[model samples]
Target: MGAHRRKGDGAGTVPVGGGRDRYFDALRALALVRVVTYHAFGWAWAGLVFPSMGIMFALAGTLMARSLERPAVTVLRDRIRRLLPPFWFWGAFVVLAMLVHGWMPGWQIVYWVVPLGDPPGNAWGEQAWEVLWYLRTYLWFVLLSPPLLWLFRRAPVAVLGLSLAPVLVLTFVWQPPDDRFGTGLWDLSTYLCCWLVGFAHREGVLRRLPPVAVALLSVAALGYGGWYALAHQAEYGGYDLDDDPLAQAFWSAGFVTPLMYAKARFGFDLAGLARFRRLDRLVTVFNARAVTVYLWHEIALVLAVPLIDRCWEVPAFEAHLPLESQWFMFGVAWVLIGAFVLLCGWVEDVAARKPPRLVPGARPATPAARMAP
Candidate 1:
């Protein structure tokens, strides 16, 4: 949550000053926006829909790394409490909603309850379960963080550097054809790099890198990322972008880490140029509700899709008409907004707000206890 000291009087807008970590809010908002738009309109910006999560990994690492003074068990507990309950609620809701809508094959409630419904084999894989993958992946990362912290404390940069070679060798050079690689944890490697780099970012590593050097690296990565994009764009006859070698190159833990680090550390604070306080407040609101929005947004769309598909048709005079491309995109946007707002309002009181210890030596859900991500 980044340190912050509330300033000014109660009657006035809470000045987000005094070293408040607005960067995290900004980063989190980035992830939320990317995930929402990617799911709602995969074709809108298909090649670039890669999530801001790698940055999130970096942020989580930075946060966890900073909190290394705390017991590992405490870190695990707070993370679990922050992540789990909403998951239980929404995961269960998705299953029941599917049953009512006749989308599921049977009354198998455990699939949703156990957090195992969206396996790699599922039709849409984890995306079918919407935001559950974050839960699974994040929890896994948190559990692994203590050991990682030990290694990181020893030689943070070198360890992070070690990550890249393996990524290139496994995800690129050798290019395992099967989706699942050596370990079940392969998909998480790049994300972990981002997390660790975020830890590095916390130590002022990227800021120390000369701007020109970082710019050159950015240019090179972008070139690689672009080439990756062109070779794999789904719009140009491919079904998915993941198959492209260059795309794999672009997505490598190595490629993304420096770029993410550069952006996080070096992104200019031109946000002051934003025209209105409304816009600022709106962004903050989005950040506050990000988790709720992520969890329930698809459900909102699922509920609205059928009704909207049957009942509403955009008239020609309406902007971006004919219900495809931009208009379909806009409709999805509105649906997502409504869903996000409603869920945020309902869940604000409880989401990520775990109570104090109910017992000695016992904390709320800890480690990989409740989280999937």
Candidate 2:
């Protein structure tokens, strides 16, 4: 515990307070936009997003490792608060969208709240309760980190080495069963590996590697992910339903790790972007309310689809659009996404406001710190 605490202080370099990590927040914003564009356009135009999303998850894994320094219970409580409140609020928006569109009866509202809106024929229509997949998986990752850290104390390098070796072999060799949920739904297991990799990162395994090591690895991983997605586009559509275990393993081990390794070391650079501080501040506000944005974006999509149908002769957004007009679809999706982001931003304060600041002396922790004797 003592040494780990030092790691928490030393290995942990990011500052606290603003709850704003500009680079990482931009990553999240980028990933969500990619998801929106893909679902809107349904093609490889969003090729880069898959690896980008992996980077965000690995960074999250790092965040969980460091946050464990605080009382786990307090941290867990805040995690639930920050994640669920906005989810609940946006959930209501989804229900309202269904009601407005007359897609379902008003009395069936409870199903939406419970997140079991599986229609008889199409299960994918289940709205996933508005980006709750990431939140739920992230919560699981946070819950599981303490034990992973406990393992880190005994055999850090060997554990990572062995885990990576088998997964690598399996990724190139096996295709998972698509009919059943086993390999199809990698769930927390896949992302868990990435999270633990972050813990290994904190253990100083990665620091010893040369700068070009991760960069070269990132390029290799990106190439593999692109070719893999292209090879299986017919069966998997660039990804294996986000459920296939084997594909999930490839994503985490082959695709995700390289991105994490790259992102941690400033492997990429952006230039001439400094004149946009005001633009960045607005984006900062958008990120601060990220929970709200994730919650509402889907509902906005659901509503926008029908409204577009009423206004235009073309009723279909996903199925029958001309191949040449993909950019038009992309623009529409961004407009809807932007609208939802702003609407949710207005409601963010109500949900994401941290538990009231310690009112003077009545706060939970006292000012004086006593060393562990």
Candidate 3:
């Protein structure tokens, strides 16, 4: 998504200027901010409040559906091209840092080049590498999207239900497997529902549902998800969604489905003059550099931890400061994120085949202009 269209415009359309939607750009930007904040501060409520990962997958799914208008091979090639460059850049940096720190490079290191599975991480890069699961999962989704889309188009409800069945079984009937591939597959099963919901959205299937029907389904999903979360709270050690995969999956579906309905019914509009223009530009920049920001923000936060700790160690600062405060770390994380964005954001521009800019400044051409030759 980019700030190149009005809220209700279609995702895949090719207009005179880029045809990205401001609503999606803003949502994605907010997701990026929320994820970075949640990671830095350990905010338990963040998952419940936003379900950022689900939203992100849904957004990607919509874009993927749009991309499929072209040949599937072309779409796959483009997806890999756009996705892998930034990953390769970051992976190379991580590898270099690990090698310099005396970690031996081995066969597992090959995973960095093509991270179909989670790569082995050294002590220095473990925190940074935690985010790679998304990359691996996203890669799988992209590879599978053509067939998935075909299945979705043929039988939307059946495809959607089938996607969710694995999660339900693993959550209730069968124990989820403990191996890395098994867990990764389990996670994929969970998010696939959200992704297919996105496909429904792109194809106008979601919009066809009566508002009452949407609301009722949402309530049922939320109710079951809530019951599951409460029942399994002890199993998870707390209300932390990350610890309970089933709850996380159900709750995310509950949250994302209704939001998608709302987005269709009443788009996300930045109201008023003062806020709109400022937010427009900010969202533009964020969407343009989203991949870079997402990939590097954790590393920034990890790096900032020592600086914050050093600050706490200062005798003058120690007594008055709450070193572990989430707000405090959030501020520090943003600063570091800004720095990292400036350093590496050009890669996103290059990957997108757009001219490199520190920030995106182009605005969507008007509808009339878009209709012009």
Candidate 4:
């Protein structure tokens, strides 16, 4: 994921130490923290403040475009291998748990294997498994990227517009389908533009734009998003952009554009933290174990719910606490999340083919010596 350097693209060259971007790592680490924190607390404003999903998809798109320099099949295989092992580990555990709790094993269970669509879940596992929609969408993006890249290289603007058109039509002009598969398809359509923006970033299209044009585009997008949010608040629930797919698409583009610009121009500097080796190690661990963290955090939250509820049942604890308070529950969730990471995070290493370590450094691994086939 741009962890290694490639020959071309001087503008995007990796910095001295090993070609890793601390800025991207820091951004990703922050996004992960925000997503976990928001999910734990159900903070509506958090979605507004940080469009974490959009930022993440954009980041993945940049990496996918970089990987596309290799054969498309190789890229797809490598991406799937990196993704599926940890998912399978987690999915298998959850499914078995559900089965033990009396869920019937059936043909639909096969969806858990590839998960191109959302897998069926029992009452015992539904909340914990809801996040798989992201993985399913990501798989589709990876599958479509080779052809998308080809089109982007040929006609960048047309391709981007085409990617964005469906979101506008679906959100504004036509009614989106209400069923599960239709809803999933609509979600993919809504976010594909953000993904394409990543492709644009890798292609240096964003960097090439005039600063004024970039700023204008960002402001216009945000303005439209704000208007859309306010206009639809009566129909939807609140100003939360997540309720309005079109607003989310617009707002996310606006939110990510400037950060991408800053990354392209200034990049993140860690020289000031030259003495903070432990902090550096923590960031490395967070980035390396990101998939593990994302996969398990929700399950951790679900498990924490009972413990927090028990605290509420205690007379002394209930006396001072508001019935709606989730602050303590949020803290408990992070603790469990950390515990899960330590217990099973090694699967991410195995999936990536990296040697297992609690914390990995920023260096790229040397290629293993090969034997003649």
Estimate TM-scores for all models. Answer: 0.70, 0.67, 0.86, 0.86
Where does candidate 1 have its weakest 10-residue lDDT segment?
A: 1-10
Candidate 2: clashing residue pairs, number? 4
Report the candidate with higher TM-score, 1 versus 2.
1
* Weakest 10 consecutive residues of candidate 2 by summed lDDT: 1-10
lDDT of model 2, residue 1: 10
Error of 2 at 28 (Å): 1.9
Q: What TM-score, to 2 decimals, does candidate 1 have? A: 0.70
Q: What is the lDDT of residue 322 in candidate 3?
A: 71
Per-residue alpha-carbon lDDT of candidate 2 for residues 75-194, written as tens digits (9 for 90 to 100): 667665566555566666555555565555454454334322311111233443434445545656666677777787588766655544444444556544432232212344445556
lDDT of each: 0.52, 0.50, 0.74, 0.75
Give the winner by lDDT: 3 or 4. 4
| Residue 65, model 1, lDDT | 68
Model 2 residue pairs with clashes:
183-245, 184-243, 184-244, 185-243
Task: Give one digit per residue, the lDDT tens place, for model 3 in 1-373.
Answer: 1000001011122212465566666677778887887777676777777878888888888788877978999998887888888889888888888889888867887778887877887777777777777777788888999999998999998887677788778777887556557657766877888888888877878888799988887777777777777787777666666656667777778788877776666654343322567777777777777778878887788877898889976987787877778778778888888887788888877887878777665666899999999
Which candidate should be chosen as best, given lDDT against the real structure?
Answer: 4
- Candidate number of the best TM-score: 3
